[model samples]
Target: MEKRLTHFSSGSGCGCKIHPAKLEEILKDVRSDVQSFPNLLVGNEASDDASVLKINDEWALVQTVDFFTPIVDDPYVFGQIAAANALSDVYAMGGKPLMANALLCWPVEELPAEQASKVLEGAKSVCDKASIPLAGGHSINIKEIAFGLSVTGTVHPQKILKNTGAVVGDVLFLTKPLGTGILSTALKRGKLNENGYEALLRVATELNTIGAELVAINGVHAVTDVTGFGLYGHLIEMCKASEVSAEVYFDKVPKIAEAVQYIQEFILPDNTFRNWNSYAQFIDCPLPETFAWLNDPQTNGGLLFAVAEHAVDTLLNTFQKHGTTQFLLEPIGRILPKDEKIIYVKR
Candidate 1:
C-alpha cells in the first residue's frame, strides 16, 4: 500500500507556518543582542531571506533554516520540496550552499520507518544537486512528519543581495508561477488531477540556483524567495525594507492554469486568509478573486528579483544565454515611488 505522507499532518507544507501577523506580534517585544555584532551583515531587523555574517573582506557566510510538513502524498517528493524550499533562502541571498543539516520530526509510532528513510533520501538527492553535503542534523519523535534543512552558504561580500535593496523604478520578476498552495489544497481534497499534481511537484522541486547568477548582474538590486508569506506579503516586506512602493500588474503575473480553476471552485488553503489578513491594509486589489493568489502561501515557490528598468532586456538576454527558459523570467510588475499604499495591484 502507498503511504500518503500528508495524512499524518493536520496542516501541510508551508501552510503550517504561523500567521505573519501573529508572528509579528510574537516577535514585537523580543530583542536579540546579535544585532550588536558588527560582523553581522544581515540580521532579523531587515526581515531578509538569510542572515549573512562577514567572514572577511572577500567572503561572507549565509545562514538560513526552513522546514515544513508534507504537502504531497509521496514522502520523496515532500522531502525534495522541503529541501528546495530551505535551499532557496541561500539562493535568494545570492549565495551558493556549501553544507546542510537535516531537521526532521517523525511520528515513529504512526508512520513506518521506511517512509522516513525515503524522505531523507529525497532530501539527500536535492542536496547532491545543489552540490552540498548533508553533514548532520537533529531529529525528534513528534506527532507529525516534518522535514527541512538548515543550510549554510557563502558569497562574496559585495555580491550579497537583500530584499531591502530594491529601488524605485526597478522591475520585478518571479521565477516560478504562483498557486502551489492552491494546488496543494486541491491535492488534500483529492480534487487535483494527475497533470496538476505533476505540475505541482515539478515547480515545487525546482531549485532557485539562478539567484546566484543574478547577483553578478549589476542591475539586480534586490532578491527574495516567495514562501509562506505569499507574493504580496513578501513584496510588501521588500517595499517596507526598501522604503518604496510597487505596482503589480495582476494580469502579467504567472500562475498555474489548474490553480485558477481550483480558485474558481473555491478550493483554497487556510493560509490564504491568514496571509491576506496579515497585510491586507497595505494592499489595494481591484478584484476580490485576486486575493486567492495574491496572498496564497507557497511552499518551495520562486525567486522574486528586482532589477533596474533599463537592465530588463539585458537581464533577459543573460537568462537566455544561461539556458533559463522564457517562462521562468516573466516580469510581473515594477517598483514604484513610495505611496500611501505599499502595493497597488492593477487588474
Candidate 2:
C-alpha cells in the first residue's frame, strides 16, 4: 500500500522549526568576529538568511542550508518545496543559485526507499528550473521523514542585501499571500479544499528568484523571505535590525481565500501560536483575532521586500518582467522612525 506522507507530518515541515525566541537565546552567546573573518559580510550576528564570504573585489559567495519534514503528501512535491525554500535565502541575499546538495532523513523501517528517490526528484525538478545541479547529499536513518537542500550561489560583493537597510520612508511589499501553515494544517486534517491545495502548492513551489534582480533596483533596500517565522515575525526582525518601525495596512495584505475562511473557524497549525508567543509584544492590533494571519507560519513562503517610494514603479515593472505569479504587488506598509510599537497594523 502507498503511504501518504502528510499523515506523518504532525508538527513537521517548516512549522516544526525551533522557536524563534528560543533560537535567539541559544545563539545569543555566539557573535560574529569581523576582525578574524572580515570577509564574512552577513553572519550569525543579525540572523540574516545566509552567511556571505567576500571572495574577491568583484564577487562574493552566498551559502545557506534548509531542511524540513514533509509538508505535503507527495514525496516529490515535498522535495520541490524544500529546494525552493533553501534557494530563497540565496535569492534574498541578491544572489543567483549555482548548485545544491540534498539532505535526507528517512524512517527506513516504515516507508519504502523509493519514496526517498521521489523526494530527490522533486528537489531536482526545482533545481533544474533554477538551472542548478543536485550535486550530492547526505542521508541518515531516522524515525521521521525530512528533506531539503544546501544551496550555494554567487553575487556581487557590493550588491548583497540583508534583512536590514530599510529607511524611514521605505515601502514594504509581500510577494505572496499569507496562510500556508493554516492551509497545510487543513490538508493534514483532510479539510483543505481543492483550491486551497492548489494555492498552497503554487506558493510553496514558486521560486522567489525576483530577489536576485532587486539589487539592480535602486529603490529596493532590504530583502528577506517570509518562512516558518510568519509575516509579522520576519517583519519585526527586519524592523529591529534596521532600527525602524512599520505601518502595516491590515486590509491591504493579501491572503488565501480558503485560509481566510479557515481562520474564521480557528483552524490553524500549532506553529501559529508559537510564532505569536515569540513576538506578541511587538505587534499592536485591536482585533488581533481577526488578524491572526500575522502568526501563521509559512513553508517555502514568499519574499518580503522594502523599497523606496520613488522606485515603486521600477520594482513593479521588474516583478512583471519576471512573470512570476505573486499576489498584491502594491505596498502593504511603510517604514517609520523607531516608535513605541514596532509594527502598527492599521485597519
Candidate 3:
C-alpha cells in the first residue's frame, strides 16, 4: 500500500504558493486606486487574473508577472514549469503574448550561475514555442531560488475577456484536470508512482497557448486560470465580479485519474486549506467530503471558461480541430441568477 504523506520533500508548481491570507496581510497596507485609470479593463479592486491597459480604442495591452521558488528538484523542469505558469496569465485574459522578460532570484554564492542559465533557457524554449521573443529581463541575488516571466500580450479592446463578465445561463468549462498539487506533493515525498509523476510533469510543463487560441475563436464570456487560490477561490472571484452565482456538479469536475486514490492516501498540499479558508464565505458546498479536493491549489492548471450555450458546440468543435481534444470539456455548472451570490457547490 502506498503511504500518503502530508509534506513533500520538494515543492512543485503553485503548491509552493504563499497562503492568500498571509499574502493579503503583506499587501494590506499598500494602496492602489483603480478609479484613476479610465482605459484599464482589469486591475486591483476586481481581483482580476491579469492587468490590462488600453493602448488605443481597438487594442488593449495585457501585462502580468509571476515568480516563485524551485518547486521541483530538476533545474530544467523547474524552469519550464515556472515559464509556463507565468505565461498562463496572459492566456487567461484571452490574449496572445508578444514579449516576455525573465524574472530571476538566485543565490550568487551558493548555486552556480549556470543553473540559472538553464532556467532561462527553459523559459526561452517555451517562449519560442509560442512564437514570442525573450526580449530582456532583470535578475537579482536572493536567499533562495526563484524564476518566472513578466509577459506582455495584446488583445482587441472589444474582445478582452474579464473574470467579471459571466452572465446567467452560461455554461462553465474546465480545459484540464486538477491534481497537479497532489501529484507534486507525492513527488516531493518520493512516494509518487513513476507514470503519475511523469504525467503531471508533461501537463504542467505544457503551455496554455492552445487553450488561449480556443478562447479567441470561441467568444467566451468569462475566463480565468486556476492558480494559488485554487478552483473554488477563483470561482468565488468570478461569481462576485460578475454578480452571478454558480452551481458546480462535483462529479463533473475533472481530476487526474490517480488523484482520487492519492486523496484517500492523504497526499495533499499544505496550501489547500489556506485556499479554502480565504474564500469559504462565498462557497456554499453541501458536501463536506469534497472540501479538500475542490480547494487543492493547482500550479499550471487549466483554463475555466464560461461560454454561451449557443456557442458551446462551436467552441468545442474548434478546440478539437486545433488538437485540444485532450482538454476535458465537462459542464460542471451554470451561471445562476445574479441574486444568489457567488458560488453554490452541489452534490
**What RMSD does each model have against the real structure?**
1.4, 1.3, 3.7
Error of 1 at 24 (Å): 1.1
Candidate 1 residues 1-347, lDDT tens each?
76578887888788899877777788787634475698888888878889999999999999999999889988888889989999999999999999999999998888888888888899999999999998999999998889999999999988899998798889999988999999999998899998889889988999999888888788899889998889998999999999999999888888888787888899999989888888989988887878998889999888888999888888898788867767767789999999999999986
Q: Whole-model lDDT for model 2 versus the true structure?
A: 0.88
lDDT of each: 0.89, 0.88, 0.78
- Candidate 3 scores a C-alpha RMSD against the true structure in Å of 3.7
Tens digits of lDDT, candidate 2, 97-141 = 999999999987889889889999999999999999999999999
lDDT of 3 by residue, 86-186 (tens): 99999888888999999887777767777778888888888888899989999988766678899999988887777888989999988777888888777
Question: Top lDDT: which candidate number?
Answer: 1
Candidate 1 to truth, TM = 0.97
The clash tally of candidate 2 reads 0
State in Å the error of residue 130, model 1.
Answer: 0.8
Better of 2 and 3 by lDDT: 2
